[model samples]
Target: MPQPESQNQPIAGRYELLEEIDHGGMGSVWRGYDAVLDRPVAVKLIRQQSVTSPELAEEFVKRFKREARITARIQHPGVPQVYDAVLDESYEQLFLVMELVDGISLRSYVQPTQLLPVSWAAAVTAQVATVLSHAHAVPVIHRDLKPGNILISHDGTVKVLDFGIAAILRSDVTKLTATGTPLGTHQYMAPEQVRGGRTSPQTDLYALGCILHELLSGRLLFTADSEYMVMYQHVNAAPTPLRQLRPDVPTALEDLVLHLLRKAPEARPADVQEVYERLEPFLPSPGAQVSAPGQAGPAGVPDPTSIFRKPYAPRARAGQQSAAGQAAESATAQPAPPVPDAVRAAIKVAYSRSDALLEDDRFAQAAEVIGEVIEPAALALGSESRQVLELRMNRAAIWLLGGDYRAALPELDALSDAYARTSGPSSERARACRAQAARCRAELGQVTDALAALRDVLDVVRSVDGDVSEEAVELRRDIGMLFLAQGRTTEAHNILEPLHADLCLVLGPDDEMTSEIAEVLAVIRLDLDGPPS
Candidate 1:
């Protein structure tokens, strides 16, 4: 199969493939950028290995497009929005563009040393059940519902992935294997599924039971050396009670798992709703304390129960102040002896190298070039020397350009404070730094604070330079785009409509800035009002 030749190459002339997210037997996924949409997206590229002949190829394309369309029909927050599906002209590759979900998978939460708390397990299972209910209602059976296929997003929303993908991939696998073995997750497969029987909502329930059991027991429900052995266990073996492994497990909860693991599809819970109901007793109620000692997952893992505890809560802002930011706040920059000639020359060389690297779109390497001289330069000319601070700012900018927002955010925050300390808060350097930090915040998904920061900067800009000035225009445009990102379309349209008119008046309708704003306004108008009659 043909692979992407360049790391930064745009796929099909629109989706710029940045970094590889993951790879599997089928193909790989990329953290891609949509040039047209100006947003980050997850792109799954399907390889052509399954299509052995032209006839199979044509059918593959038809089935792939149909599955993509049906997957998009699942209108739930738990389902990542499918933005587009692109089949390459050569039929060599297919791309599924989807909303980028930033979260730890349940696989990460499964640790033999620390099984999840009862509430945590229940919270995750309940959320998945809710998502399953939505998918099944659309008559979409997730033929392969496994822990890896589920994601707990940062905001604690449980997202189900690849709804129609299993059905498509199963056919491909069966054709290749020519073995009659069923093609679902062996550990989570229902007895009927193991027998190559028809799957339904009950199959999904069986998978959910497997997930819940693993979450509570920190082990697969059935384990063996080979896929065939695991499949056989699913069909014939009886599962051990959860309490036997973890006596703290409630008897009722254990019973629920046994009921779900029943060999027959008809013997399982009636539907996902029933599974959700059974899980409710172990879930944290609204406003209830979500954690107890030993209840937390691995450090840095988000609390899934936060959704029920504070339903519909805005994403908790990223760390307001990293440790370095705090130190920068408490310690003042002290003047030191003049820098030596050799150190200054090294700093200059580093800057030249970084500038060249950046020109070639080698952002990470560019940041590294700057980083190499920062410590030596700081040692020779005080830590907060103009030369050292300049290097820090440039590196941080490179990180932001590279889409390393987490690395850029804290540095930008500290840079803003440092600039304000040296130059007054209203000075050009300080305001500019603050504005850049706000942009970092926006990219990091702290929309509320980011919007507030940008507005503050805009107010300062308008007071000095009029609202139509270059900086003011850019800030206004950014605020409108931010609002649009948050799904406040009417507000976004209200902000951008007048802004577009102003851009046209000042820069003319054909100007690049004016045209970009006009394009966004066109999209917003289309969303607010239906398509033309």
Candidate 2:
């Protein structure tokens, strides 16, 4: 451990030391003030050792310089900006100056009793993916990515810390760490990494997997009485699936986690881009409500998902009085021109085009076409008219299909309300709309509310249609998935086991739905049995 420097002393005659922010085996980090630049900075001072020989000191200097160079090469917002690396005349002390990040380390957020929301965990992982993507492009492997090295900023931006052990994948530089010893946190090391084998971008993915699993389950991926045991588990033991511990975790997400934890580096997702794509469905869309709205953990604690939930959404430009006046003027001015017959026909053509585009997987173009008709259709026909409502509903469905849940969720809620009024609350369309909204909620990590809404819908469907009806059966399956997500495996098994039997009788075992239910049953059984030895 390095002793703290005198508070009044300034390193390199520029960075004025203030107070210690953190200390680890490597060095001490201080909250510093740049006297010349008149700005705050984080100063990391490498611990000085009384080496008996010059060779050890020279080796330390090379490692220190390598860390600074590798970290600087990673040009990303998720990484703290490296300002300077200072070596004194006698080489007794080393210092690294960097941007002062006002945030808490992710280690503080890990709790045994309280797990983070699924979206929050996914969002953090996604940001880390973005960071890793940038770092890997520079051919730098983090080698160590534990919770302690991840910081959630005050604005909810995730900043990956500590590239002190990062390895620059260049043909020229020799291997840094000793050949026999692995370099990473025991709980998060990939099998290849634990075996002291070559590491690549996939090693970082493996570490991220452990972090995400911990975030969702509120516990480490593998915990043991000794570090050696934990390392052994990383190499030889299979991870307990997140869904087994926290049922509210989506099956898709659990599968992603498992893929990331694959023992072989090649078995993981091909790149960070693939990991980010996998995480997209679980990330909250712009303006989407978070699972725990308004309550972002303890006061002053940042919500990691805020970036995804409200990414640069501009506030209303008009002032309060100007907005009110504009609204009143619009209410009186909107009935001026009538939509022509040609325009109505064009709108119909647009809807047809959108449907075709949707089939081609051109979601953005499909959405654009549907959006183009919405205003014209609403203006010609009343906003509440069947044609306009149908157009809006179709647009919402497109948004949902595109995975733009922020836009889809509000539209679904409004459509549900509109259908309840126009077509009676008991109407199949209204029930279907509400059920779709519940699914959106579930995807957004509002599991409890989604489960409740699903139950209510299921009750209504069962009351009107029979238990064996297709709609009721589908609802039961959705409910079972929610139960599985919430970690209620017994309940999920109980519900899905019977539902699978019914599907076989009604839809036959060959049906897609039956096959899907069968897969879920297999997963549940595996969870019950524990991982294969």
Candidate 3:
């Protein structure tokens, strides 16, 4: 979340960066101080070269506001407080003002500390889970939940920072003509995330499991030399067992972590609370004797410093040279065996025209393009290829529009199950598929199921690096209507009111979502036969 380079410039005429603290593919963070608040702070300054589109710039503003509002809603002591969001100078760069934390990231703490004592790891995990439960309750997903994002303060307090904003800076720019969505830090990413599927509380659970695995084994859950390979691992790799590295690691903690590492989101714990409950009874309470609670050492005693690297190196090697050589090899061997030219051409023809068809209201034709045309073309390439599943997603969207929700079922359901094996339960793509499956269930009149689908959307959007996009607004609108249809007046009003306000802000009063939600409210009022409820 800290974007370096904030040190040189005065942000919004208030905070001035002192120096670059860290840098990454997304942006850089800086150490700084708030001139107004009169305290030390961190500021993230997005790179100028990275800003590629006007729409993306606008999205940055919206997401920045979303972070400001959403994160501020959580007063968790284990979570950093958002000081301010400053966007100025043509909106090209944003400086996010946040509480300054002087501590090593959990990733770093675990490297030299390798295989933290189970009790210490569990206590830390519990603290993280506690914060996660609240964040999920608010329905915020921290798309990137690797060790670097977890901070162990000087006082031994554990704070979860850098929520889900990273993806806004690094989406799939190369995949413009591609059917598949981009992904997050691949190693820690859950299986669902790799397939451009949906996420929920379970996605975070998967990440926690990865953290647990690493903490106990001093090893990454997956090993790939490059980002693509890491992502492939998420899409199609089995996790190594915790006990494989350290046989003495407690059976239940190992079970709990593996449970989170399930191949399917459905098989995982429902929320962070479940993760906490699974590990807490054995954990010593905060400030308790480190040995008793199962803490590694007194919070700062052994020190979590040097444990792992930030955003984490996907694979470990005996030396830096070997690691780089492996990375180069992995980069050169992507999508394995290379997508064929003919298959590539066919995929381009079948999948590249989504928005145009949606605008034309040729929903069924679009479905045909994806299912009959693109899907077959992809299958002609290889039915089991990543491109095949990618195109299937396009077809599923069409299925939603044509109101043939059941027809969408085979793709959605199979994809959901497939992603569990591919990405692990926690990946954003896996979560996305789960959310899409939920939508299909709702459309099919499985009220109990639809509620789950909409509920899952609420949780999925909270994930880090997710593409909730317009789907979020659409889900709110759909849920409002569904509740009204079910004669659940109170629920309808609750969903519709915020949906109306959000639509008004983004789409303006003249847009369809705003207009549609307005009409729904009117119907809701009439149904109440009195007040608007």
Candidate 4:
């Protein structure tokens, strides 16, 4: 359900930001839904304060666009796919729409009392290296790579997040520096980054080393009282070897960590390939039973090596039908038994509550009220049954009224076809559904498709109830307005001229609807005649 703060308004007319997922000094990330695609997305809203001046704002926009394009080119499964980059008209808000990765951050797994298994740490690190290898090939350096930016997805695949975010944030950091707003995690920052030097793939390797060290030792590689002290330690301090903190760590793995942590960029391993090679020794072989090496490190941790153990394993079979799936499948799957009396009564009550919610302008909650009864009603009455279909139509109306056009569009389309199949295409219900679907398309800026859909419904209405019917008049007005919006003034005039005449004949020129059409036609005529000579 959408929150009140969002009020169903979409970002850039596409993504509807739902809930704040994470926040930092730079900006906040939101769990959002992409209305046009009907899918979930993660939206990162960059802080505007970073762009202090006109020149910096211009530079930031250019850099943000460039970074977004490069980030999209990485093309690795470990990297969350970038869907789009949006800068609002005023350039005050910047957003990056990305795949909503469902996973646990590596930060959550790095508790002081809970050391990760040696093989697990190597598996996670190796995966990160593989991702870095691809990104580095694209010549992208992840300026900030830390445990918090790494995630293990549900299927045991590592996801390196915020691929180009740090670079975008750094664009305006020089201006923000005076405000004492730091740009990166100091503990995981590379020495070069700390010293304000140029960064390359080697810089990311240093951060990866910090992550591996923390994963193995169950603590940050460096600790200090302040960010300055942390940066100072990063530049001057020698990282303690992993084996010293975790005796079970293999010598070669510790050596690789040390290799990654080398202060000089050129002093680090040649590339991520070399780092992965050293890690290969600790990684489990294909189909190998993976377990913590030497000692149990942590309980209930998701095994990162499962990708190797069962590469591309098939989806697990569900033992029982899920209620969500059941509800969806019941639509057009097969007819079930008739609705029980108790459920029928409950559906009636639900309808009343949903109507009240809709009157209050709580569209999401209105839809939710109907949704609560859909599953049970669908299970008993069957999907295409009159009662169930009515419930779906009402729920879809709520979505449409809420300005969730993407959510409503598909459901309306489906319901239209269902009505046509069950009650005949020219039936009032079917025609109404088609008109509603057109309205959704129009709202979503699909003007061409919306016009065609509206025309088709209007033709059907004319055949059923004559051209002067209320529905016919409304559809004609909608089609004319769409043409006018597209600047097809002649076509709009032609459509509305006849429509306005009919409204006056049927409802009288003084009627509200008739007068509104008269007003629209008056404006169209003025535009046609070039503004009263």
Determine which window of 10 residues in candidate 3 has minimal summed lDDT: 304-313
TM-score for candidate 2, residues paired by index: 0.57
Assess every candidate by TM-score: 0.68, 0.57, 0.52, 0.60
On the 0 to 100 scale, the lDDT of residue 240 in model 4 is: 91
Task: Kindly give the number of clashing pairs for every candidate.
Answer: 0, 5, 52, 0
lDDT of 4 by residue, 1-533 (tens): 12323326778787878788887656778988775665678988877786888877887787778778889999999999999999876667788899999776888778878777788888899999999999888777787788878888756789998876534234554542333433467988988887776677888899999999998898999998898998998899998988888888888888888989999999999999999998988888887764434534344445687887788886443223323234435544444645589779989999998888567576766787798788778778777989989999999988987888877877888899999999999999999999998998899789999999999999889888999877988899999999999989899989999888887788888999888878888888788646667
User: What digit string (tens of lDDT, one per residue) describes model 3 on residues 504-529?
Assistant: 88779998768978987887667655
Per-candidate local distance difference test: 0.80, 0.81, 0.68, 0.81
Q: State the number of backbone clashes in model 4.
A: 0
Candidate 2 on 353-416: residue-level lDDT in tens?
Answer: 8878677666655776788777767777777888878888888888788787766777888888
Error of 3 at 298 (Å): 9.2
Q: What is the Cα-based TM-score of model 1?
A: 0.68
